[model samples]
Target: MWGVFSNFIACEIGFWIVIILGLFTRYVLKKNKLGLFFLALTPVIDLILLIITGVDLYRGATATTAHAIAAVYIGVSIVFGKSMIKWADERFRYYVTKEGPKPIKLYGIEYSKHYLKRWGKHVFSYLIGAGILAGVILLINDSSRTEALLRVLQIWTLALGIDLVISVSYFNWPRKKDD
Candidate 1:
């Protein structure tokens, strides 16, 4: 049990280490392509981890709940990792180096419209992500495959709902009108 858990933990650590290293290299060290290159390779690490898990299962080892969660985690992270890291870097840089969150505009759309569009993209991205993870989960022969896939869908749905609420609330707020 500890062995399986430790391996998954190591994978998680490796996952974050790659992201952080890429982020630091790209943003902090000013190596934009290098950073993006590192971030872009995150899915490779995920694939490797998945392969490791699959090999273990092939060797007659029992799959645990931890393995299922790890699959979902890797799937979601691979799909959203680069964009999430980019978004965080922007906000972090803006807050620390400039004012608050940077305002984004597309095709003359201002704050709320911009955020709505962004959130819409996020929703679509997460849906695609969920589909990818679901397909992968379906391939696994664990007893919890259905539950794990359902959990992925549930989490993304909840996230989209929260984002919708925040975007709409911010758009409808009177104080920030015409800004």
Candidate 2:
């Protein structure tokens, strides 16, 4: 049990390190290609951790609650990691570029007359996607009811937090006066 806990902690620590390095290189250093290379490596690391967890299970080690939770967390992270990074990158560039807001195509829509409306739709899409993911996780998870519920809540909270940040940043962004 202690071993499993230690392993989970170590994996999480390593995961964040990879994310920070990738984002910093990609966004801060402007080494887009290299940043992508690092970002793409995250899933491989996740896969390795999953394999370790699986091996322990196969070796007759009874999986504890933490073990199950760790597995679920890694799986979800792998699924959402790239998309999250891309979304953040897009928003970060939008803010830093300081391009005046104007009616423009966003997420395939040809035009949005208002920034709030566009951001609302964007946030709604994220909510729908998160709902689907949570539904899938609930269907697949065989863990304790409490843990599954907690996981779903965590997903919702994270999705909402991210969406809120993006929406707020765009809404509050400085806009040039329309000529």
Compute each candidate's TM-score over C-alphas.
0.57, 0.50
Mind sharing the TM-score for model 1? 0.57
Model 1 weakest 10-residue run by lDDT: 103-112
lDDT of 2 by residue, 26-139 (tens): 777879899878777877777776677666655656556555556555646655666566665565556654433432334322222344454565455555445544553455
Q: How does model 2 score by TM-score?
A: 0.50
List, residue by residue over 66-164, the lDDT tens digit for candidate 1.
555566566567556766777766765676446456844333236667778768777666765566556655666564534644665677679889999
Q: Rate the local accuracy (lDDT) of all candidates.
A: 0.66, 0.60
Please report the candidate that would top TM-score against the real structure.
Answer: 1
lDDT, model 1: 0.66
- Candidate 2 local lDDT, residue 17: 78
